[model samples]
Target: MPTVPASRVPRRRTPAAAVVLSVAVFLGTVLSGCAYEYSADHWDDESTSAAPPPSTDAALPQDPHLNEPVTGEELDDWVDAVLPDAAGQVFQTGFGTLEADEERKETTAQLPKGTYALTLACRSTRRVSFSIENGEDELVDLSLRCGTSRVNVVQLAADASLSIKVDANAPANFAYRVSRI
Candidate 1:
């Protein structure tokens, strides 16, 4: 290589710090132009406002027979009235009257492997306790108030025996139905 004097060598004309400061200033100017401001007049315009749509649902009908006492055929009729859409093949249906002295009543049914809805209702009673079991395993236990009905969904993995026991606080009429859904 040919030898060159120290002052004769060429060097970069621009310093790195100057180039970085120039880039920062350019970005700040560009970003400031994108700022937005909202005014009261803009919000007053209906076209830019957000409002909820009106509801289309009507009020539910009242049941006049909810507080009445019923038994035997009338008990069954009440169940039908409450659960109007009992849609599905019914596996079991039971209706009976419980005496004030009776402690409880238990019923059993053989249900195939499937999903089933168990509906229970009672009238003329203070409260009633319902216990449902699949063989040795208790599936559902609930206390139902008089003049009301409750539906529980049970899923059976295999064909099994189901036992339902109802205990009432006062003499009342009760009805139950098990249907596959």
Candidate 2:
């Protein structure tokens, strides 16, 4: 009897059969776990799956001018209504001061095309940051100290409107002075 070398043995290809069998086994295993009935009556039971009808409460009145841009006079009136003491304060090149309570308060003014300095001094017991915005954009965001002042200079190439908004993290009373230089 002649002994054949190990390298001379023919290797039969079974990868295709193995792959097909593996895929069939995997699909059978997955499908066996999903044995749910497909009947409309199974899901249409009123007692088990009925949602309550929506409440028929009266609709709230919507503001007509809610999306309108605020005019200078309207902004002035809003400031006076919220912070009555700060009303009628002029924001000229001189000095103007305003007090802010726990609620957010705003002051709006029209600025000419020039460079001007702004000074903000707030006496806040709680931590807070004041925001200066032009339209929807924030120009200055200042973190106020208890008894200190911060100053910033802004330049306007075109005539624009600006609004100063005071916000406190906690309930606080803050007195801020705005001076133009």
Candidate 3:
């Protein structure tokens, strides 16, 4: 008997059967992973597991290095804590001079729409706070040195004037002078 070639044999192509088998295999695979119940009585039952609740312990504390407020005894305690027991701090006392360019008469102290220049010098053993108040005459006052060696230079508005007195006895270590330029 002669062996027949596959191309010559009667080919029975059942497209419907292949399609049905493929759909049935796919449905079986997909349904295996998922599930559905048909019993109406069991559908209402709730027997599934529940998730555990979250922990509610104490909260973490904040760091103490962030510039805590010091007052009264606390300030004294802090000064004492930081002060070294040894002597010789190399304390130097001197005067520093500053000048403002009179050409452009304006400053960034948020001065009003006007022409003005004011300067003050303070000589003291401690620092001085600067303050600026807005009004008819923008006031500038600086805590001066102990010797009261504070000088104030003022150039008022065009036709405007001010009575500025430079007190040289504020006793402050640092000299702070502000001028509108």
Candidate 4:
């Protein structure tokens, strides 16, 4: 059988530099996550950006459901894949009796639309990012390279609220959000 060239596939519109950074983030963050080493170094991209802190009295969801946090497993499912080295290192620590809210949805929080902020507590700082794709395969691949990964989540207001919760015994917890400048 004849083989098709790798170039046959359309390239992502994301800049090559951005792809490198995103991959770096995946390699740096996911490896630790899969190793069960909780860390926030993963959000070095999101935590360092210009996203400002939100006011407590700012807009909020009338539904208490929005106030709830997103779980690690939920975030895991959204992750399409990981660095080649991290593929076999996934370590899960299950402690909850309550099931994840499957009906919950994600509304892109990046500005000028709106920024999404979330909190993640872990034993290390190497866990970062969310790659979500709808039917069109338009994926959200934030990385340290594009400078969209490091934002103070609590200060950012999201069009739709989401969260990432590690076990309480985990090391560090981050409260972050993504929104327009």
**Candidates' lDDT values, in order?**
0.78, 0.56, 0.40, 0.34
Best candidate, TM-score-wise?
1
Candidate 3 residue-wise lDDT, 91-176, digit = tens: 21122321221111222333334433333333333334444444456576665433233433444444333333322222222223
Pick by lDDT: which candidate is best? Answer: 1
lDDT of 2 by residue, 1-181 (tens): 9998777778776999889999999999999898767777655756666676787657866454432223356544433443323222335421122333344656646766676556554433555577777777777888876345566777767777777766665444343434334
Better of 2 and 3 by TM-score: 2
What is candidate 3's local distance difference test score? 0.40
Give model 3's TM-score versus the native structure. 0.20
Pick by lDDT: 3 or 4, better one: 3
The runs of at least 3 residues in candidate 2 whose Cα sits more than 4 Å from the true structure, single-residue gaps closed, are 1-101, 177-180
> Residue-wise lDDT of candidate 1 within 21-77, one digit each (tens)?
899999999998996888767667566465657865668564755555676676667
- The estimated TM-scores of all candidates read 0.58, 0.41, 0.20, 0.19
Off by over 4 Å in 4: 1-125, 132-139, 142-174
For candidate 2, what is the total of clashing residue pairs?
Answer: 0
Q: How displaced is residue 29 in candidate 3, in Å?
A: 44
Per-residue lDDT tens digits of candidate 4, residues 40-141?
675566676646666676476455332233458743432222111122212221122122221122443223223333312211223323333333343343
lDDT score at residue 94, model 4, on the 0-100 scale: 18
